[model samples]
Target chain A: MLATMLYGPGDIRCEEVSEAKILHPTDAIIKLSASCICGSDLWPYRGANEVTAPMAMGHEYCGIVVEVGSAVKTVKPGQFVVGSFCLSDNTCPHCRFGFQSSCEQREFMTGAQAPYARVPLADGSLVATAELPSDDLIPSLLAVSDVLGTGWYAADAAGVTEGSTAVVVGDGAVGLMGVLAAKQMGAARIIAMSRHKSRQDLALEFGATDIVSERGEAGIARVKELTNGVGAESVLECVGMEESMSQAINCARPGGKIGFVGVPHGVTFDGQQLFFQQKSLLGGPAPVRRYLPYLMDLVLDREINPGKVFDLELPLADVAEGYRAMDERRAIKTLLRF
Target chain B: MLATMLYGPGDIRCEEVSEAKILHPTDAIIKLSASCICGSDLWPYRGANEVTAPMAMGHEYCGIVVEVGSAVKTVKPGQFVVGSFCLSDNTCPHCRFGFQSSCEQREFMTGAQAPYARVPLADGSLVATAELPSDDLIPSLLAVSDVLGTGWYAADAAGVTEGSTAVVVGDGAVGLMGVLAAKQMGAARIIAMSRHKSRQDLALEFGATDIVSERGEAGIARVKELTNGVGAESVLECVGMEESMSQAINCARPGGKIGFVGVPHGVTFDGQQLFFQQKSLLGGPAPVRRYLPYLMDLVLDREINPGKVFDLELPLADVAEGYRAMDERRAIKTLLRF
Candidate 1:
């Protein structure tokens, strides 16, 4: 099997790796159909997050199951499936309560940008479609594994609903998906903070009502202006930087809700502002598994086209180029076909 | 009129101040029936919070309407009323959405430890009871004005429901009231964290299932131990200190909710832990006005006794003593009777 491996910052390689086998009775082997680079993956590639030794990369994928352990009952071989970044048991107290990301037996998926991979907790993690999706729809279905599901989680956590005025921070793939999620959920207005022309177009296509190119205080001022000097009812903080976090908080109305799904970096919040300003903040690794069914349906039914985020696509052997394209901002996301 | 005024840190005096009168068409002059010192007041009294010059004290009280501006129609002379620390125009979007403390036209209440108070936004801030209550109920009714109301907001914000395991971080008057609020809301197990025997007794009396005297890490560990290593379902952070805030977040089970009503001081959260831990945190000033009506019914029907928090009572002339008692820890709360 060939998989993408991260040796160090700026060093990505696609080479032959050990064959995938059933690690446990609950594990299943997946023949990767499509996998993509994520903004979060950039953290380790840029050396911001510590990466010791070479490790398998890619935590997002949609694939067909080639083999399954005896213990895997729900998901079976020969099924097209999508799974969350977090492999959950789905029966733990946390999973039962709808927080699969924090499942008691949760495991992070890696080495997914490969020809084959082992998926543990198959019964709980993998969701099978009625049939294999068309090749054109594979990219969108693949996004449901992480980015799209994360965006949906952000909107759900922010309490975005019909008539809700939503503010989306960051113009990355996840941020664009957040716009789509808010739109699908019936948000009356979605103000996307985007500066890039390409992302701005995608944001608008994803259903952004307005776009604010400004950053920092000016960005917040623009959102406030759009919200009648109050601010958005629900704010999605899709970027994890401190500046992005602060902007999201400031962009919400007093007593408004903020849903943050970014993998925070150097982010710290003033407790006084959160308490006195009455901006409710909720964030973390998204519970994407909980929303997979709903989002998969949306993707399969063509209600949403998240695959547009994959502006660059390459063969699995060119995985190194995929990382570079995203790292250099040459692509919003790069999908690797196996 | 005589009022409690703060000249600086550790300097308080009962002195004659400007007379209270209806200052605006929406204002009502109330003859204060009862007033109390709050934990927040101690911040300024102890020099923790700056007090630049002599300022009127006492932001919590229940009083009798003595006069009203022509615009004040709902509240008239002779009616007893309770008001939150924040005077809101209940008609604002935030207030209409049930967040009166964050009302756009909100004003902080001050100078209530005097013989009279000028209640602004009278129609929205003042909740008139059916009639004058008996002497014994006066203290409890006064609690409804702030402490009890604040505690109730904490529980409500934390999403407490039947069978919830509630952990209160503070053991002060508000924390005790939170225990009572949890009880009234049908929480299955209420855990009050306190080191003081007096407060522990009050907590047990208020329906606490267990008392964890440990503070900080030990306190969080104790809570986890009691909840089958899962932590509590709902955590009420009644104290605004960093240690208490962190404890509350750590004490909540994964995906659990935290309602913090404490005025945060020098508290900053580690964004990474909050992001990956999947804990939902929301805090700010309590929207006490929204709960006033429902709570008033509970107090009037003798369903709750929040006034038990008043451990010391002094005449209005001995206002300085009232502040001293709470400052010296000789009382959990001090009531200044006018």
Candidate 2:
């Protein structure tokens, strides 16, 4: 099997590797219909996150189950399924509370860029479709596994509601998806902060009512100007850098909500400053398992075209090019076929 | 007129000062029925906050309006009224959204520890009673102006609801008021983290179902034990110090809300740590004005006895002693009368 691995900074490789195998009774093997490079993958590839060793790459995936452990109940072999980037024993208290990402037995998915991936806690993590989906919907189904689910969670956490205004801080794939989610949630205004024309066009296609090309203070000022000088009611902080976080916080009115999805690196917040801002904040890994079923149905029904986010596609052997394209900003997202 | 002033750390004085006069057209002069020392006063008195000048010390009051500027419309001279510690133009977008403390023209009431004080933005700041009640309810009505209102805002921001579990992270006057607020909001279990026997008793009387005397990790562990290893859904962080804020965050479930009202001094949060903890945070000066009317009605109706929080009483000339008693923890709260 050929799998993706990160050797070091800017060193993504595709080479022959041992096949993924179930190591626990709750695990299952899935031959991925498709896989993609996540915005998060750039963390180690760009050297933001230390590459301590050759790390197994990829967390977003969806495909047909080729094998399942005896203990797996809900999902079985030959069934099509989509799972969250976070693996959880979905029966835990946190899982029951709709925060599967914080489940007691949680583990993050890895080596998912390969053709076959081993999924742990299969019964609780994987949502099986009733029947095999058409080949055309695989890209969208793969997105529901993580990217789309995360964007939807951002909107839900931000408390976006009918006739409300929303501001998206990043123009990445997740930010574009957030615009779509906010639109689906009935937000009257969706503002995407993007400096690039291609991403801006995609944002508009995904229902962004306005685009602010400025960054930092200027970006916030533009958002406030568009929102009647009151700022937005809901803000989705899709980028986790210090400047982006500050911009997202400032773009919301008092009592407004900020739902941050990007993982923070060196960001720190002053308690007094945040208190004076008087904004509500809720952020963490998205509990994609909680939304997996509904989101997959949306894809199966062809109600949404999240697949459009993938502007670049490559074969599994050329995985290095996929990472390079996204890292260099030449691709919004890259879909890989086996 | 006798007033309280903080000259420096450990130096509180009761001195004869010039009487308060209207400085703005929206101002009103009120003869305080009662004035009390607050937990926040200790911040400057203890030098946590820099006190560069002789600071007028008190923010809680209920009194009879002695005079009103020509522009004051809602409140008139000779009426009994209570105003929030935060003066806000209630028509602003933030105030209209129930975050009056962040109103466009927000101001903090000052010189409130005097026999007579000038309240700015009177029409929007003061909530007047239809008629004056017996003197027996004066203390409770005064509590509504700030303490009780603040506590209610903490509970409201933490999303307390019927049958929900709540954990209070402070045992000060405001924290005790939070217990009362949680009770009124129908929390099935109210846990108060307090080591003092007297404060714990007061918390129980105010409707705390449990009391954890431990401070840090042990206190969080105690709360977890009580909740069957699952933390409370709502946590009220009434103390703003680093230790208390961390305890409040640790005492909540992943999806729980932490509403912090204590004025944060040197608190800073690492974005990565807070993200992994997955707790929702919303903190600020309590929008006391938003809850003032409802809290005042409760006091007037005698449905709640928030005045019980004031354990010591003294005359205006003994204002220094009042501050000393509260500073030394000799009294839960001290009420000064003219």
Candidate 3:
């Protein structure tokens, strides 16, 4: 099987790798139909994260179950399924509380950007639809496995509601999908902060009521002006950086909530300022498994078409091109078809 | 009227000052029955926070209404009342949403250390019992105005619940009250991080299951060891320093919540670490106005005896002695009688 491997920073290659099989009683072997490059992947690619060794890449994927272990009762061969970035034993206390990402028996289920991948805790981690999804829905379902689910978590964390005025910081695929999530959650006003023209346009199409081209202080001012000087009721921080986190805090009204989905790089809390302001920060690695089922339904129902984030596509053998496109900012997200 | 004022760091004086009166249409003048020194006052006394001018001090008090402006409807002359440190117009959107401290039309109502103080937005700011409280309840009602309310906010923000374990990071009046709050909120276990014998005793009486005398990493380790190596489910940070804040974060479970009511001095957020940990942070100045009503009811019923926090007492003319007691660590909190 051909799989993507990270040898070092900015060094991605598609090479022959051992095929995956059911290694555990709860495992399921998936023949991936679609997978994509993630915004988080760029972290290591840009040398922001240290990659010590050649590691199996990719975590976002949707596929058909090729094989299933005897203990995997819910998932079976020939079924179309979507799985979370992280695997979880659904029966754990944390998983029962809807924090599957922090499941006690959690496992990092990767190697999705390959022809086949092994999924652990299959019964609790994989969700299957009634029928095989059409080719057009594949990419959207693929997104549900990670990005779309994460976007939903961001909106939920931000407390986006029917009449909430929300600000989304970042213009990556997850940020763009956050606009859609907020819209779906009934937010009346969705402001997407983006300087990239392509991402900004997508944000508008995804139900962003307004777009702020500025960053930092100026962007916060524009958000306040858009919100009639009260700032947004909820802010979804999709970019995890000091500047972006500060901007999110500045753009929220006192007592408002900031839902951060971005993997934070360097951020600090000013206890006094936060105390006086009354703002709340909530979010971390999203529990994608918690939203996979519902997001798959949304994809199937055509309620949201997050697949549009895939501006470039390639065969599994050309996975390196997908990474290159995203790295060069030539693609919002790159889809790889098996 | 005699009042306490801060001339500079470690320079507190109790002397005759201008009498307070109804300054706004919605204001009411209250002749204080009791006032208390707060833990936060130590910030300036210790020279941690710069004190600029000789400003009237004290933010916690309970009193009898002496006079009311034409617009004061809910509170009338001769009524006994307890109000928050922040004066807020209840009619504003922020106030309506329960964030009264950030109300659009707000006034900083201070000078509670004096015999008389002005209460802003009296109609919405003051909560009264059926009858004027007996002397026994005066101290308890005084607690309702600030420390008790703040403690409740910290517990609420931390998401303390039945069977949940909590870690309290301060040993002041508010921190002791936080133990009470967590216990009332059904926290099964509470670890009070304190080195003070008096506070530790008070925490035990308030339902703390354990006490940790260590600070920072060692304290966090103690909390984790006590919680089966998973850390507490909720962390109440009542101290505003960076070290205390970091300790709170380190003492919580991966998916736990940190409710910090401390006035943050300097704190930084490491995005990558926070994102990976899945912890949530919430809190600020505290919506004391939001909690005053319920807390007042508890005080009326004698369900909580928060007044025990005051270990020293003085007349308004000798309010400076009360400050000295607290500044010298001779008292957990000090009360002033009119």
lDDT of each: 0.90, 0.92, 0.87
Residue A191, model 2: lDDT of: 97
**What ranges in model 1 sit over 4 Å off?**
none
lDDT of 1 by residue, B1-338 (tens): 78889999888899988899878999988988888888899899888888888888888878889999988878889999999888998988789888899999989999988889998999999999988888788889889888998999889888899988999999989999999999999999999999999999999999999999999888888998998888888999998998889899999988888999888888988899888777777777788899999988898999898988988988988877877888888899998887
Better of 2 and 3 by lDDT: 2
Q: Best by TM-score, which number? A: 2
Question: What number of clashing residue pairs does each candidate have, in the order they appear?
Answer: 1, 0, 9
TM-score (all chains, Cα) for each model: 0.96, 0.99, 0.92
lDDT string, candidate 3, A1-338, tens digits:
88999989989999999999878899999999988899999988888889999989999878899999988899889999999998998777678778899888888777888989999899999999899989889989998888888888999988899988999999999999899999999999999999999999999999999999998789989998888788888999998888998899989888788889988776766556667777888878788988888889889999899999889989888887788888888899999987
Those runs of model 3 whose alpha carbons end farther than 4 Å from true positions after fitting are A21-27, A68-74, A121-124, A195-201, B21-27, B69-74, B105-107, B120-124, B128-130, B195-197, B209-218
Tens digit of lDDT per residue, candidate 3, span B81-197? 899887787777788778887888776667888888888788878886779888998999999888999899899989999999999999988899999999999999999999999
Docking class of 2: high
lDDT of 2 by residue, A119-142 (tens): 999998999899999999999999
Query: What is the CAPRI rating of model 3's predicted complex?
Result: medium
Task: Let me know the DockQ for model 3.
Answer: 0.57
Q: What TM-score number comes out for model 1?
A: 0.96
Question: What is the per-candidate TM-score for chain B?
Answer: 0.98, 0.99, 0.97
